[model samples]
Target: MPIAITGPNGLLGREVAKVFKKEYDVIELPHDILDITDLNQVREVLSNHMPTVLVNCAAYTAVDKAEEEPKKANLVNGLGVRNLALACRDLSIDLVHISTDYVFNGNTDTPWRIFDVRDPINAYGYSKYLGERYLETVNPKYFLVRTSWLFGIGGPNFVSTILRTATKQTELRVVNDQFGCPTYALDLACFLFKLVKTGAYGVYHVTNQGITNWYDFAKEILRQAGINIPVVAVSSDEYVRPAKRPKNSALDPFPLKETVGSLPPFWQDALSRFLSETQTKECLD
Candidate 1:
């Protein structure tokens, strides 16, 4: 049986498709190609391919924008996932859904555990939580992987944002209050490929190790890219947004150590690898 991946053009999905295709016959499904929100489309596509595993990297990830358009977010993240779950169940295909650490309220200081009660403080998180609920209840064979602060080559991410911003400005102000671990998309993809093959069938927290807030993360990105500039760390209150971010949404690696045998490399190491791969000179221009 072969593996199929949704959102093959996305940051994580691109890597997931690349990783799986190296080992198994892979089907690539982008949003335009397969709209998960439409039940008829999902069922028809799945039925036609009949892939053994379906990795859902597609989601409505507009954090602040979701506040204004909660319905759009829910339609894609919540009801859309429900449609995929229902189809996967009928087709007997294993579903692997990508989630965010924002699912937690971010009230606690420590790392959020696997089974921590989900209390999303933002619309985006709540939408993803809805998807999780649908996936858990609807499908027996499912992998719910919650990750955070993703940075990769294909997508517009924080790393790219900081790099692009630094070129125009001498000093950068970043929020220091919120905290979470950064995850390399390729690393996450490799792990997911290994995970589905295991048939663990449960929740897992996957991210590069270590915790840091936005300000510090930005500083590290510049440092890695050999960019020298003044980075001023500011509190969340100083740099407010439309959505409310968790104070500390760091996820704890529980059974990842047991199931995957090890966690992904540290955030700094992953950042170094990303820098090495990316065109730092072009980012500055």
Candidate 2:
């Protein structure tokens, strides 16, 4: 059976299409072709395709800007997910929705469990939380995989930003107060595919193992590129954005490991592969 991947041109969706195509028939329906926010469009397009699985990668991910344009974010993130959930329910299709750690309130120190009390502090977080609630309510057979700090070849990411900044400036300041596990889009794509096969329908934390703050993550990215740059560790207060970020973005993958029988390698290993695959000598050197 063919699989329909929404937002197929996105950072994670591109990887998902590439990986899943090797195993299953894949149909790429980006926003131009299938608007998840439009319920009529969603139903018309998905019914025409009739894929067995629908992996929703569509999202409005402008975090800081989300504060100013919350309605746009909620419409895309919350209403869009709801539309898909309804369509999947009608079509008898399995849904794998890409979620974020932002759904958490940035309060917990330990990795958030599946049933943690969600308290979203910022607009973006609140919007994602709404999406999660809508999806779970509308569909019982769905896999909500939450990942964070993703980087890959398909789009601009934190890793690319850091490397690009290092070329023009010797000293880079990054926030050390915020912590998370950086995920390679490909690794996460593979894990999602694995989940699709297992039919393990529930919420699961999916990120590359281990954690680091922004400053250390920048350091590691520079080290992998063989670039020497002075990284300044600044507090979150020192560099404020329009949106409030999670001080604790790290996720526990114990549920994923127990269900799938294995987990992706540490984020460092993923970063090394990303650099080798995407970075040219001009970018690294």
Candidate 3:
């Protein structure tokens, strides 16, 4: 059976394509080739391929920019998902939709469960929530995975940004209030591969097993890279952006142990592997 992936060029999408290609016949559908926002186009493309599984990595991920261009965000993340869900439902294609932790209100101290009430505070979160609703309602055979603090090689991410800034600066000020798990895109991709194989059709919360604030995460990044730098911790208010981020967006991997047999490797281990891969890529270039 062929597996089609949307947004295959994105951070997690790239890794998902790589992982799935190793075992399955993968159909890579970049936005230019398959604009999911266009319903007729989505139907036409999926109908032509008729893949067994459709991995929707396509999303409006510009967190801060979403504040200004909410319509565009909803178009891609909200109604765009409805298009895919409708087509998948009609075609009986299993939909593997990637979601986010932003759907929950950040005020809670504990980790968010898979069935937690969704109360998104920002435009981006609301848009993703809309997609979740559409997918849940339209497609029954779907894997709705919600993750957070993604850093990967396929695109510009926090890890790359921090490393780049470290070269020129002596000290870095990162938000210490916002806490969540740091997920390596490759790790997440591998998890999705394992998950889709089990025929488990429900919502799942997945991330590298652990929780830490941005300041601590940045310090670890510098430490793992063997870079000596001072990471100054600051409150969220001090580093405010166009978007209001949740203070705590940590997702609880409750059902993952039962579904996948074990929790993912610790966040530190994933970080080490990511740094090694980053260094190797840099050297090869």
Which has the higher TM-score value, candidate number 2 or candidate number 3? 3
TM-score of each: 0.97, 0.97, 0.99
C-alpha local distance difference test of each model: 0.93, 0.92, 0.93
Work out how many backbone clashes candidate 1 has.
Answer: 0
With a 3 Å backbone cut-off (N, CA, C), the pairs that clash in candidate 2 are: none
lDDT of 2 by residue, 1-285 (tens): 799999999899999999999999999998889988899999999999999999999998988889999999999999999999999999999999988999887787898887888888889888898899999999998999989999988787999999889999979999999988999999999999999999989999999999889999999999989999899999999999999998998888868988888999999999999888785744775
Candidate 1 clashing pairs, residues 3+ apart or interchain = none
Q: Tens digit of lDDT per residue, candidate 1, span 1-285?
A: 688888899888888988998889999988888999999999999999999999999988889999999999999999999999999999999999999999999999899999999999999999999999999989889999999999998898999999999999989999999999999998999899889878899999999999999999999999988899999989888998999999999999898979978889999999998887787745776
RMSD (CA, Å), each prediction = 1.8, 1.9, 0.8
In the range 26-82, model 3's lDDT, one tens digit per residue, is 999998899999999999999999999999999999999999999999999999999
| TM-score: model 2 vs. ground truth | 0.97
Q: How accurate is candidate 1 locally (lDDT)?
A: 0.93
- Give the distance in Å from residue 105's predicted Cα in candidate 1 to where it truly belongs: 0.4
